[model samples]
Target: MNDVLHPSLLLFLGAAVVPLLRGRLQQAWMLLLPAAVIVAVFSLSQGTAGSMTLFGVDLLLMRIDALSLVFAYIFAIITMIGALFALQVKDSTQHVAALAYAGSALGVVFAGDLITLYVFWELMVFSSVWLIWCRRNPTSMAAGFRYLIVHALGGVVLLAGIILNVLDTGSVAFDKISPESAGFYLILIGFMVNAAVPPLHAWLTDAYPEATVTGAIFLSALTTKTAVYTLMRGFPGTELLVGFGVVMALYGVTYAVLANDMRRLLAYHIVSQVGYMVAGVGMGTIMALNGSAAHAFTHILYKALLFMGAGAVIHMTGRSKLTDLGGLYRYMPATLLLYLIGSLSISAFPLTSGFVSKTMVLEAAALDQRALVWLLLSLVSVGTFISTVLKIPWFAFFGRDSGLKPQEVPWNMLLAMGIAAFLCLYIGVAPGWLYSVMPEPVEYNAYTPGHVLWELQLLLFAGVAFFMLLKFVGGERKITLDTDWLYRWLLPRVVTVAHRVLQRLWGGLLSGLMARLRWLVETVNRHHGPQGILARTWPTGSMVLWVAVMLAASLLVYYF
Candidate 1:
């Protein structure tokens, strides 16, 4: 691959040309761009790291290593899948935006320095938000605005951290930093925001479901996953990530379990899936990092598959609420099967890609003697099973048919989902193909009698518990409040109350001030025809006499 015609650069520049073209040409440009980048990346077997300096700081335009390559490969794969899923959409604006969004993420993965990473980091934010707005609905417009604000805030934090880091260390290398200082902490917090570590996690669930069908699939693949990659690159072994990951895992499961919207449920699971990867990165072992990278790869596949499946259903029926849909399996058997495969993989079921990858993270926790973290991870497995596999498909496709008859999705959409679903099974059945490309060599085995038995037991017993607690766990008509509700609901209510109080206070103050001023004016007017003595103007003669006296004093001083 020529450096001048670097695949990523060519793809990005070519994507910008897509909207100018029409129909088949635009579609070809959109689909081929990611394929070209993937080919170029594969051609370079050994890793390469290089940077360009600007403004006295290094800007890493290209850094090819095993870690980045792993993410880069999946990002490209998901982008291709997304393009296929989006073939039905004739809007060139969306097609180009999706390609640009995908390219920006690939650029970030290859970035060797903080400056280049930041540039693409912000590009990811802006380019992706267009996907949401492409929905062209009021809800999506509002959600996109919120999404922009959240990422804009994250970008600002990231920029501040990078600037402070360059000032403090005189280096812009995007390497791991100790979280013991303010600068490092600032960078960590910025990364955490995108990682959806906590309170900030609301952005994904709030914004993603509002995006257009194909748009949601792309959204599922990039932003948070990029954050995960950055964390793996920049904050591996940070103890705080362990706690952060656990919280996100549990947080995602809880909200997902309570969620009613089909896409929103999957959005919460994104946070949960990333939680596993975050914990793996925090473990910082060869096995754990491999698991993190591999899980992230597979997660993008299955997660996008699930989102595409959901999108297909919504596309036909024009509804996204799970309660509003059911019995779709009868008409769209392919969709049903694909969704099940994705669900099973995401649940870490045996013979699925997730089983092959997620185990390493759990094993890392156990090996590190973090028993509490291990136990929590196990609970998350159960939560994941309940929310995604059992809940999502059961409610969306298997429950009572809502008397809706929609044909199978378009050939291209099904083709994309099929590719992803097949990979889920292929990778699970044969893990070596994926294991070979890991960021680091791993000796741990994914298939073991003990591991299989425990996972089966965990999932089996969780199933039994769900049955036993069916009444408690069943879906409801109510919406569960999340952190976003405070700003979106409670804060506005509080502000409204504050405004009323302030208005009343200001009205009273103005009335009292007006009364006092009126009284003063009346008293002055009564004393001096039109106003007070001081308010009355001096006579012209007095003014002339004062000017003459001043002139005489100046003349006397000059004479003296």
Candidate 2:
């Protein structure tokens, strides 16, 4: 390994040259960059690769540990897949933004200091927003702005926490810390915001569906997963995450059930799936932490696969709402088949990646004797099957035919989805391949007979319930509200009303002051007008006589 050359630097520098290339050359360049980074990642030894000191503060530019390596490997692989999916896009700007976003995520994964992490964190924020804006529509534009605002706020919170932590400890190292101080709590808030934990999560659902088709693939794979990586690294063992994670798990399912847009439905599932990882991090046991990391790895692949499948549908039909799509399977069987693979994986069916990864977290909770946590997670798994597996595929592919005949998406898109689908299956069948790369040793088996039977029963019952309530759970052409209402609607209205009241008060004060000044001017004019004593305009001679009289009086007084 070249000690001085960081893998992230390779992608970032490569992004700079992307706009300069054209056609086949650009496509080749994009593919080569991620492949080269994969090589760089494999060649490096497990330690800090690039280190430096600035102003007496130690900075680790590249930290190659088991955890970071796992994330870096998946991130590089997804970047390559996203590039492949986007090969048909003629816009260089989207390509550049996607590459830079990938690079920033890699930077965050490997950063060994608070400052370095923050720099990459902000870069991720800036670079990813462009992917949303690249759609060049009003909805995308507005969504991109909202995305930037939310992340910018998260960045501020993170910076404050970093500053306070550095001041308190006099060290800038990025390591695990207990949430015993104001700084760590603030830091957790920052991480949660990025993780899209419930109320702070609307930005994700708002922006991702609005992004360009190809851009949505990258958006789905990176941002929140990076935050998952950070939380697993920094705040593992905080009990608060357990509760929040459960709520997020259930909350996402509820919204996804109500989601009308296909992409939006998938967007909500990201929250649901990430909730498992967050809960595992909170559990803080070796198995749980390893579960979180492993879940992140599997989630990135499967979720991107899901997004790619959805993107292909939208690309072919120019419609993403479930109401507008139906009987697509007849036309795009390959896409439908590919999408079902993702759906099964996310639903944690037996012999899928989700089963392999998500069970670790649940088993940890069960071992810890958190009955409520275990129950809630179990229920959420059923909801996941209902919404993602049953609702999404049934409505989009097999529901009432909309009489729209659309061809399959381009080959590159199918190729990307194919690769992800294969991985999801491979990981499920050969869990050891994934478990071997985990941060800790793996002793748990996902394919135990008891576990498989229990999961099958849960999924089977959920499938039955979904069919029974299909009418009620059917997609409605209505928008459901979330915590985002506070900022998106309520807060803006409050600010506008406050502005009106303040404007009226200011106007009244100005009017009163003007009226008083007018009255004073009138009084002055009344006393000093042409008819008044001072304004009688005494001649120069009269003025001189008054001066002489005063002088004579002065002299008489002096004589006396």
Candidate 3:
């Protein structure tokens, strides 16, 4: 097992080669690397490899267990899918950024210690930002900057926690960190930020919508999902995460319902869906943890499918807003069909991947008597259906015709989405294959008659409500600001006001000081000028007489 080629290394190496080759060779390299990673991940066993001591501390590079294997497997799978989606993309930089982003995420998953994890954690931020910026526009550039800043801050907090925790415990093992630890909150906030928990989640919605289509595919799958993997690894069962998780679920749906941008709506849903996994980690039951792992795996599949579908629309129509799109089903029949499969799967419809995974968390909540948690989470499913299943299709493809005649997406895009759609269905039909790879043994059945009945009723009623309230829920043309308003809107105005106030005060102070300096200089010039009385020329004899008079006055004063 130690002799097995490292999957992360394969991707990083592949990324380097992406620029050197051209045309078909580069494309071949892209698919081949992830293919190799798939083989490497499946070949992994439960062991630590690449162990070493640095500065008198032991470090583990590779920690292969059930949990790590699960993430690594999906990451490898998505990388290949994303590469295929981008096969028609001519930008070599995107291919490199995506590969490196994937590599770093895999590194985080397989990391055996906090040090290794932190290193890869930062790499994920730096490498992935390029995907957003590669769109090479003002909006994307700004979004990329914000994305980089937020994730970097998260990484810093995480690093601070790691340093403090290591000093307190004298070890850097990346395991279940306790709440009582000095660095616990810092570490939790750091993870929550990346997990797209609210107040810290603006970056994802802001940048992801603006990312390049192909890059968004990788973006949707990797960053936050890796954060979820870390939470599953390091902070399982921490009570606060339950609160954060539930908030994320509600917050995402609220903003999503208000969204006009197709990708932005999907981004908010990322917050919501990841919320399920976060809550499961907080529950910390074997069933809950298994649910979280399974959900993370399926989420990558369906979420990527959704983003790819949305991306294909943007690619074909050169438009992404719901207000700008309509009646596209006929032109892009294959796109609409594939997109609906992902939509249905994400909504947790019976016989979908979400049906199997999302229920485990709710069932765990019920078992633990967290009725409020279960109820709120169940309600979130209604919103999921309204936003993803009902709202997106109603506005974008099946609603009134927007009069834009666009062609279908290219074959590569369809093939890539086709692969993801197939997996979403496959996992749904046979949940056991997914459950078997869970961090723990999963015993829950998602297809109980009562369970299936409940899901249908929830979705059916939600669909009905969406149509009933259709007048108000239609996409608005105005900008929808999230917590990002603090920076994008409020903070800049604050800076502007401060700058103006300082400028006025400095201007007045400088003007007054200059006037005083001019007065003082004029006084000196009046006395010192050649035309002045003191400046008049005096004879040498008069100066000598004054000196003698001064000497006599000194002698008289001394005698007195």
Candidate 4:
């Protein structure tokens, strides 16, 4: 009944009960819990709660500021939506894992200190990987392990940074950090890994496609966005991030074009879309930071919706490869329609959620006079349209028929997608509703005549380009090598080679050792063998003569 309760606490407690209940009651409880959290989140006032000192340092379990509240709100909304999408799932473990993952993400958002943040930060990794592993397939399991290793390393890096920062500052306050401080870049890399920045981002595209149909919805929403929240909090205005952000945006677009798996392609777009957020954090202006937060919110919605549509296809057809998918629009017209809304939203088409949100970052860029940043981001938008809007839709749903004839997904899935789809359109049509939640005041206008005109032109051009390069853009039935190849292919090969070398070296040393031992045995045998002089029947005569000589010498010496 406490109004000051942490949303994460509620979710964690709810996750424990999911396995205990059954049937309709269990489903009802699952939906009710996140619904309640959403209400509670919106009801919260700006302040900290659950304050106490741990090991001589004060901690706030719930810090309800504008920024944290922004993330918390969207997180709660997506948890409910994800739960709804997963309502038909029979696996209680998956439900528990999904809820726990969402809770941990909320925990990260509201955490008022590095220690509290870390506790939830790690919990997010442990809880979310199950979504992948729960699929109970070899590919999913392998990808899950890789996901674990990458995040585990990232967590170690972040923890080291926290330890160094704490030692240097004698405090664990999670506030705006100075870049000159000791743990700055380490913490940034830690956050960057979560944000799915390039080189460190392959885990996303690698694992997300392998998750359960419903579980992919949550995966697409939480992990990387939470990293963006942290980056915005910890390292805003670190100009180095501008370059990193640009690379992430382009990197995602590039690989997404190569992706044959529909979900994997969308996963790459996650990295691309989050790039705007990372750049916004780097810009550090109020407008820019708000853009980052706004984009995270909108991204979670549209991205989750997109995943829902993709998952519905995968669930029904038992296939995910774009090369294998076609003429799906004829059978799954409704799903295609819903998915296009998401596709258009992601492309920042006019009057969509992406339009209202993504442009804020671009506006921030232009205002900052970062001409190259603006230009590159604009190009990423073009690529976004080409992939998600033009390429994916055409190839996956309308290209050459692969003889698929699946029906529409379940009512719950449709309802979930419907809700997200509606929201995407609604937010686009009414930008004020989303803008009002800005951590800072909203100043940039998304629907300006010039802005809308320019965006339309860019997308129009991208559409033209896609058709021109249609042959080149269709999904191929092949695996596109990524950074994951380092571990998946190269590392194992390297280990195998090293093992062989070590074995040969060990064999040579053992051979030399045996040879030396053999020679020593031969020398010892020669000294004591029956044919040797020392081994001959010596004797009594020699001994007697020697004894007589020794006695005579002793007698002479004594006389002298």
Candidate 5:
């Protein structure tokens, strides 16, 4: 065993053997590999490791630092958690895809140069699409293809940016640069696409709900979060993100409020929650960046927990719509309780992971005196509570009884959710544990009297508003049109119309061409066919008589 190793390589190499193993051995290996990466992450010293030269360019494969370590730590933990959650899956392909996806994310986090980052960036896209495809349904298959096409476009944009950046600066280091050039803007666009920033985020909401039960958990955890890590690494302090982030936060909440499907609702919330991190990163203060990282860390746990609860329901009931689910709490009380923990955590209820983490971003906004930013963030928080805590729990678990009698999910799922839920409470109760791992040091307190009172009052009022507007806020069975409608419906219709017009033009051209050919054939037959004048049996005799008469006429004219 080498003393210095890239954590990604361990998982990537380990995934190759997964399909070869069977039964218990396979599960054990899947679990053990992520655990080993965790150990490897902590064992290594903090500096560039696994540096090499490729095409005369220095490629840094492992760049361990506080920032990278935070993402790597959470990624490793989630991989193990995802593995445990997926233990009962009979398909080897899911496990392989999950592990490989995890590895590629690690690769992105640890990559020190643009080239290395781009390589891993693409790998993440390719590997995670499997999670969608593994569902093997028409919806999943189609969503998978759409997911690939969108990310492929993003990837091409990112690659173009890298090439241009390298050409301009003569360096491929994945460090911050001014957004004054085409390369930088393209790169930022690429990162934002992955981050699920609004207008570019419909793929997440569209595809995630269609994934396999366990695969959704993994999908929810990694892709957007990796994009956050990259943004924090490269585009911190970029002011445009502040606006983008705020819109994302509110946009997600607005849509989630209207969503009818359980997983799609949660998927929308993923966008909403990630919005907080994006805003924090854009703020780019010590506390804000820390908040972004901390929020990302906690978001993964709670979001995964939330997905697990929803997935368990789908797994047991074979239904995911809010209209179809109700009275589940009567049968699955434990799941309900665990899921509530996640709900509280996401809503940033006091003494939960979200409270400890999300407040940092708010605090940063306040300290920076960005009053508008702070106000919007506060409102978004209230919306978060309304959707995830009030709407979701009420409709899915306790609302009008569709008479569902789903039993508790498998113990493995329960265990995974338990671990995540516990961490949510643990981090909230003990904020210092999370604060210590932050990339930058901050002494901000989340338990101040003013802070707690403000949070409580806002949540309390939001709760009141929810019940008052309960009828209006209730999930409808109607499909909400999003930006994807432009591509999925509107654009397709436009193309169909154009295609019909072209088809008519082609048909007319062919008809006219055939008509002219027919006329030419008739003329040729009349002039030269065997039955025509020139081709008759007496043609030679008639020609000779005409020639003698013409000669005699010419002689008479010359004599006169």
Candidate 6:
């Protein structure tokens, strides 16, 4: 094998063949593929850009630049963590699908051309949908179909944009194309859909929770972050994304506050978290971009850790709703500890990975004097404080005990969560390890006294708010609105109303035409049918006389 076949490709393609084997052998391959990819990507990062051409278009199959490196590195780490968490799953198909899905994301990150990015993008859709359906339940099947439709629309937009971009420029290089053209807007909207930016984000909540416990962990880490990577690479500095990101941030928090399903709540928070990343990219400063990339790295770790903890709980107890779960600390202490770490990290506690990374973006926003954006970020942080850190662990693990006793998770699952947990705390205390891999050289500090004090006050006040309004916050109702409602409800109603108006106008025109036809038929019947001049019995005599005259005229003409 040549080195040109990028190591990420080797892992992805290798995983698809694993299902051909039987039993435990297949499981072994499943675990090994992602781990191998992690090692492969890390090693590949040390080299220069390696280009490959197919279909007469240059594809940057392996770009080792700093921006791509940050995303690719974290993707590999999350893949290993996900694979570890999924080790106990009996289904080889889910394992292969998750690995392929993660591998496809790596391919996109490394891709140097729009065509290459798109190829991997579509592959990502196909590979991840299988994970959603891994549960083999009717609900999952429906959710997967919806998920497919949303992503397929996104794919179409991306492909159309690429084609137009290539046609316009005579090259498909993956540089930031202008967002003025139809193609660029189409591509931006497409990327936003996957990024779960408000309005089109329902698929995350509807589909992710339906995946098998093992599959959801992998699903949570890849697709949205890939969209974030694309936005960073292509649409950074687009002013519209700042507003869009703010909307997603608030939208996610609102729905998450009302969500009952444990995983679904986390999925909503995913949208919220991505909003921060998107806004940072929109800021267009080196610090902001670095913050976005760094956050993506940390988000993948802690988010995957959170999902793994949720998956372990679901795996042991066969439950996922907060109302139906509580006091798991009595039965699964390891999982509780891991879940708390993920929660604290996600909440941006001063000494966790989230704090180290997320603050950079918010700090960047403040320094840039984007007062509105900074305010929105503050509100989102406070909201995160309410919905996730307080809401998730409190309800799922420490709420009223549902009196359910389930065994602790398998050793591999615990080990995976432990790895993620350790990293979260380790990075919280020392962010230098993550800062070093940023696309640009890092000069900012994460733990300044002022920054720490501000975050502490925000989080503490939010916690107080949650307790003061505890009676109003806890409920079983689901918030029924999102950006998806445009297509799901508003668009359909608009179409239906247009159809009704067109139907009425057409019906009136048809009625008038039919009436005229009826009148003409009646007139013809009176004039030319049995009762009309042409159809009456007297017409026979007139016809005979006319025929005689014609014959005479014809005979005279022939003689002449």
lDDT by residue for model 2 over 427-473, one digit each (tens)?
99999989999999988998989899999999998899889988998
By summed lDDT, the worst window of 10 consecutive residues in model 3 runs over 1-10
Model 1 lDDT tens row, 1-560: 12433445765787778778887877777677767776766776554545555767656677777899888888878888899889879887788788888888888888888888888899889889999999998989998998898888888998898888877877888888756445797788788888887888888899999999999998999888889999999988887788888888888988888888888889999999899999888888888888899999999999999999889999989988877887888888998899889988998999999999888899888888999989998899899898778776777787768888899999999999999999999999999988988999877787899999999999989888887876566566777777789778998899999999999999999999999999997887877765667668889999999999999999999999
Q: On residues 418-490, what C-alpha lDDT tens digit does candidate 5 reach at each position?
A: 9999999999999897888889986888999899999999999989989998888877879899988988899
Angstrom error of the Cα, residue 541, model 2: value is 8.3
Among all windows of 10 consecutive residues in model 4, the one with the lowest summed lDDT is: 1-10
Question: Which regions in candidate 3 have their CA more than 4 angstroms from the true location?
Answer: 526-538, 546-560
Q: What is the lDDT of residue 342 in candidate 2?
A: 92
TM-score of 2: 0.97
Task: Quote each prediction's TM-score.
Answer: 0.91, 0.97, 0.95, 0.95, 0.94, 0.89
Better of 2 and 4 by TM-score: 2
lDDT of 4 by residue, 326-438 (tens): 88998888888999999999999998999999999999999999999999999999988888887878988898988988988989999999999999999999989788888
* Model 2 clash number: 0
Task: State residue 260's C-alpha deviation in candidate 2, in Å.
Answer: 0.5
Cα lDDT, model 5, residue 155: 96
lDDT of 4 at 380: 97
Best by TM-score: 2
